[model samples]
Structure formats: C-alpha cells, structure tokens
Target: MLDLVSRPAPWHQPIWQQLTAQQDFAHAYLFSGQPGGGKRRFASAFAAFLMCDAPEHGFACDQCRSCHLRLAGSHPDLLLLEPEEEGKAIRVDAVRQLVDFISQTAQQGGRKVVVLQPAEAMNVNAANALLKSLEEPSAQTYLLLISDQPSRLLPTVRSRCRVQPLGLPAGTEALAWLTEQGGERSREECALLLQMAGGAPLLALTLAQQDALAQREKVVEGIKALLKGQVAPSRLAEQWNAVPIELLLDWFCAWTLDLLKLQQGAVEHATSADMEKVLGYMAQKLEVQRLLAWQDWLLEHRRLFASKANLNRVLFLEKALVQWKNLLQRR
Candidate 1:
C-alpha cells in the first residue's frame, strides 16, 4: 500500500507549494511519468492535501478528522481504482462502479477524491465509461489519474484533465536522495543503480532491493558470449528464465538507442560502461537500415510486453537473441 500521508518527494516540493496555494482546483488531474518517478506518491500527497480540513505549510495536517480517516484506510469519500491483478486491463465494470461512486453525496460532507493509478490500464470500454465522469464532474470533487504511459490513454480522456508531467530530477539531487535511502550502499553503487533506473531515485532504490545488479551482470555476460559465438541463443534464453522480461527489454532498448547514437557519430563513446565495447563494435559493423529494422522489431515486442500478451518466454528470448546476433552478420 502507498504511504498516503507522507510528504512529496524532494524534487516535487516546489510543485506541492504551487498546488496547495491554489484558490481553486481542477476537477480532474493527470499525473504522468516513467515508472518509479514519484508520480504515485505525488498524487497521494496531493489527494491528502486536497481532502484535509486543515492544511499547514502546503501539506496535510495529519491531526484532522479527514486525515485520521484517510490514514486508517477508511475514508468514505476517497475511492481508489486499480486493476484487480497487476498488468491486467481495468475492466468496464470497474469504471461503472466509479461512476456510481461519483453519483453519491460525500459521506464525510467534504470534497470527494478518486485516485486511479496506471490509468493507461483502462481498456477502451473502461476509458469510454470514464469519459462521462470526466465530462460531468460533481461539485467539490477531484479525480486524479496516474499513468506511466500517458500516450496510451485516449485523446478525449487526456484532453479533459490538467496534465502534470513528473520527469527525472537533477542528477545530483537524485543521487543524494538515493544515497540516503540506500543505507549501507556505497555512493558508487547508488550511482550505478540511479543510472540503471534512468535517474529516477525511487526506481533506483527499488532496483537495489531487487538485486538487479547481479541480474544485469548475467545478461551482459550472456550478450558478450552470444556475440562471440561461445553460447547458443536457445541456451542463453534458458539461462535467463529467472530474469524479468520487462527489465531485459528496457536494457536492450537503451542499448539500441545507444547504438544509433554511436553509428551517427553523435557520441564518441557509449553511455553505459558495461556494454561500451560491444555497442562500439556493433555500431561499426551494423548498417543504418538494419539497425533501424531491429529497433522497429524490438519496440513492437516491447508494446506486447506492456500489454501483457501471453508469450512463450523461451521462444521470445531465443528469437530476440537470434535477431540481435544477426545484426553483426554481413548483408
């Protein structure tokens, strides 16, 4: 469960002040960002602020009745909508329930708030069902939508709300926060985790908890072995059975982008140290058209992964490795 009463992330304090000082609030707000960039935490904090009967210094006064109810997870006016299962679509029935919830008067006689996270999980019917609520918001009611991929949302849905993008914080700021949260982790380890998380501090901490560095090392070594023809693609895929597909795809996507930059001579070196030589070698060997084709294929599969399509893990990994190794083949 999210820490609903906690303060916003350090990078978001400025926006918190700007929002809480507002004399009027928008009926609907869309908070969008990459996963682990504190969009959820910001939304939760903002919701707490919005519902509080007493706000102090641009934050929720935790002593109020509303704050107490919210902290106890029994706030009658607050509704949270999320997929019943992770990575599943938000069904239309859930949106219909939301519509019904919105029609009722506030039991607490205060403003009503709805928080729907990963808003892109709403299927077409669910999204359409939500449009009615967005179009006809009730008095003193606010709907907050959190999305990691705002582009997947319907244009009609996006246009109805104020869009707030939560991007990665400054490198030094993120590194500092991550270091504090990382406990005994060395500064260098924290920095590496931050890099792995694309500079998102919360995500950097999560990756540390998952022991992602060891998994990453295994993947890198496997890729090197594949390129050297020391291991077969099928065997490598089998060895990677325990690795999360999403993480693997993200790393490959980043490396693919790096390859494009190197081939274009935009950068003299690769951005990540682990694969610097491999990326450099591929940049020299790969034709632009071939690399672009690989990118297209990889992106299409990434979409599949996001959509949670039923995929054969071993076959998918084997095919991906084969295609990746083929990038070095002579045309």
Candidate 2:
C-alpha cells in the first residue's frame, strides 16, 4: 500500500516480479534469509500488494482507498505479529490472538494480510498454536512469515508454508546501493564494509554510517594488548563492556579466524587487513591447535549471545580474554 514495489531494491526486484506474475498464491509463505538480507522488506511489499485494491504489476496504486488506509497505518485488514520485546519469545497468547484475527473476514472486502517477522522468536507452544492456521488458512487470508533463522522453527510449521530463500546481492550491485543509501564510501572502503557485514548491503550501509570500522580497530587493539600482557583481562573486559557483547564476540570470532588463516598461509583471505601485522604476530606466537580451540569457544559464545541467553557478560569476556592470553603462553 506504500508503493514499496515502485522502486524495488536490486535484490528484491526479481522477487517482486515473481510474486506479481503469479495470479494464484499459497495461503502461507515463509521468506527466509540471513539477517540484513531484506527479506522483511520484500515481505512487507508483498503484503502491501495483497491488500491493495488496485495492484498494478505487483505494486500498489497509492491513490486507491485501500492504499490510503494502509499508508495511514490504519489498515484493518493488515495485522503484524512479533515478539513484544526484543530477544523475547512470542507466547501462545499472541498466537491465539492471531488465530482470532484470521477467523474474521477482511474489512476491506479484499485479502486479509498478516505478517510475522523473525518468526523464530515464537516459542514452541506458540508455534504449535499457529500450525493449524498455516495448515488451513481461511479464504482470502494471507500469512507472510519472515525469518533470519528458519531452522529454529518447528518442522511442522515450516512444512505447512511455501518457503523462499533470499540471498545477498552481487558486490557491485550492493556497493552501488550502499552508495545510494548515503554511505559515501570509496570502493575499498565499501568493500571493507561489505566484508565486515558479510556481504549484506543494508548492513554494510549501517556499519558505514555507525563507523563500525573504527570500533573494530579498537577491539583489535584491545585484543592485541591483552594477548601481549600489556593490559589485564579484567581491565580490557571493563573497557569493552561499553560495546555490545554480540558485536564484540563477532569481532573476536573474525580475528581468531584471521589468525588461523595466517597460520595456514591464507593471508589473502584474512578479515582485517589493517591488523595484519598483529594477527601475524599472534599466529606465530600461539599454537595453531589452541587458536582453533579458542575459535570454537568464541563461536559457542556468539551463538549464546545471539540466542539471548542470560549469561554473565563481564565474566564471559574476562574468561575469553584470559584464555586468549593463555594461548600465547603455550608457545
């Protein structure tokens, strides 16, 4: 209803065409992709199209009554369901509400659209409650489920919907798009940002805007000082506590992988080019097996952090820093 399909992003254009070309659609559809890959944007556009009174070429006509209501954020037929709080589970009560909403006919006398984002946040009971609706959705009702980690969803829930996986755009396309998004980065800078964001265009733009490269530099310098015994693990952890634990762990994971690559004579593929000398020094001073073990630990902690586990953040960082320091002693 917002005319989102009017000017589609490069990666979403094909998906728009595919959706528009289809006259018939499944009751439930799951759009799955990595974080920052634009799956949610695509799903929102698809939802808009479904609710439009006069959709033209998969895009909503903004002049239509339905489009006006949707643009006003008062579309009676459009419902959005997500976790009430960040990193919290979607309870069965929310799913029960959605069930009741779907039971009613569309107020616009058109399609009723429901969007559930980050579908993995639904608890087991909530997911189970939603299964019946997915299995047998009412006529003229559409469910759009968006998830960055579909594997966390129940098999039965996944099996009931048509799944579509979105992938990252090409380097040139992504860079061009990032530039358009006010990134204003040179080619090398754009490439570095893309690498740091794992090739996700929107995320690369966000990282560039947030000066994440400078943040990573500080993190690398902290790790180097900790490993060299110039800074105590406790002190470093205190300093890094200001940063998000998830981001710090991600940087640590990348740095450890870069050290491993250096040890394996794969310097070209190392993540941090500016910190090559420091990474090389660590590679030479730390045992390869110990570095690999540290890598495993970092990955495990990162997974825990992503899942929002209630762990002691300060102690976690201190233990990781201490382990890293111990790795240097083993040489």
Candidate that would win on lDDT: 1
Report how far residue 16 has shifted in candidate 1, in Å.
1.0
Local accuracy by lDDT, each model: 0.91, 0.82
Tell me the TM-score of each prediction against the true structure. 0.92, 0.91
**What TM-score does candidate 2 reach?**
0.91
What clash pairs does model 2 have?
A: none
TM-score of 1: 0.92
lDDT by residue (tens digit), candidate 1, 54-139: 98888899999999999999999999999999998999999999999999999999999999988999999999999999999999
In Å, residue 290's CA in model 2 sits off its true spot by: 1.1
Q: Give the poorly placed runs of model 1, Cα more than 4 Å off.
A: none
Per-residue lDDT over 76-190 for candidate 2, one digit per residue giving the tens place of the 0 to 100 score:
9988898888888889999999999999988878999889977999999999999999988899999999898899999999999999888889878887777677545677777
